[model samples]
Target: MASPQQYLNNPNVRKLLDVIASAEGVRHGYNTIFGNERFSNLSAHPNVRKSFRQTDGKTNFTTAAGRYQFLKGTWDGLSRQYNLKDFSPQSQDIGAIGLIMQKGALGDVLKGNYQAAIQKLGGTWASLPSSPYAQPKRSQAEINKLLGGSAQQGGYQPQYLSAKDEVRLFGKSQPQTIRQKYLSAEDEAKLFPQQQPPATRYLSAEDEVRLFQQSNQNTQQSSYLTPEQEAKLFPGG
Candidate 1:
């Protein structure tokens, strides 16, 4: 008979274990981060359930068992939300590993093993667990094929944007622009009705120069204007 550790080493079992662990970790993390005054305030509110439903599509779970169920449900929901399929088992496993890693790292950090925690929870942390599902190689073509070719036809090219790229895009793209890009025409029309267009106030070259001068004067008068704001007022041509 295999030892407990040996049993954990089994690919399939490990995957399942990891998924559970990760789900638990996420719950713990959320509770920890938002558990105190904020959570209490929200929980005590009469409209808390409705608010939670709006944000998470479900109210906060009351009991421990209910919370556990909610966590599992959330994991599944996220998978669907991201259109992350075919690797359900793997995704679950990774999530579990992440939780375990997070817990271990936290414990280590609390114990002042900051470096160790950082090392273990670093960028390659997900690959640390010995599971067959860890880091499953996927190709865009394969994903497109899996998505029934509609993904390709719809210009849904899958590219892993980095955190910085995501931030940059978020800063650059307005809500309207993003919605227009991602939402179907029918959906957009339903969600956003064409209101009377905002009155267009065209600025001539003189108006632009006058506005710049006023902005510059304001910046010079007020010490509150940041360097970036000043730079924006007089941008490089």
Candidate 2:
């Protein structure tokens, strides 16, 4: 049998392990952000720094709390190095959702009726809808429509165009540039809200080709099939 060090040294396996470790670290960090007592305490522990590094075949952290602290410190250090800031309420809520989803804890928490856990870990209790899964809140226009009012009455315009509009504006073959610009603008607006005006334009060569391929595939598949064939393929009439 291969030794643990030998297994870790294999290039392909090592890469896969690295990816898994990174994902695990992120999940742990997010969970810690929620209501994980061990992780929360460990993050603030002074001994955590000394324990994380293995030296001269000597391991650190004999206690569970010590190990947890070491892991939290390692994760927090990595987060700082990578500039990952989940300090905001919205960001923390999203982080908790991601952790819950990754760990398969959503159903368990919901079933247990751990309301305090849910509220503390997931942020505002009012944000939770009837559904167990987290969903995007309705846009102002959608809310207005639901209330039987026009979008203008809600004081917000739908600046984002539909996928169809995107394909029309930038031909299917060329979409990357426009898409990048749009994403950059959006990020800038998010980071510096006062600096960026609302932008509606989005044209990208890569996106165009992608969208076109999907649309074209749908069109081609539909064209040759009879209604009966389509019904058979899709199941529902």
What are the TM-scores, per candidate, against the unseen true structure? 0.17, 0.18
lDDT of 2 by residue, 10-109 (tens): 4433332222223223344423331122344322322323332233455544211221112344435434543435433233333333344343444434
lDDT of 2: 0.35
Per-residue lDDT of model 1, residues 1-237, tens digit only: 211222334443343343333433335322322121123221211112211221325454321111111233444544454343533333434343444343454344334333344345433322223223223223435333433343213346644445454454446554543232354455445545564344334445664565556464544343333556546554641
Q: In order, what lDDT does every prediction score?
A: 0.36, 0.35
Best by TM-score: 2
Give the range where candidate 1 is weakest over 10 consecutive residues by summed lDDT.
Answer: 42-51
On the 0 to 100 scale, the lDDT of residue 169 in model 1 is: 47
Global fold similarity of model 1 (TM-score): 0.17
Name the runs in model 1 displaced over 4 angstroms: 1-83, 105-237
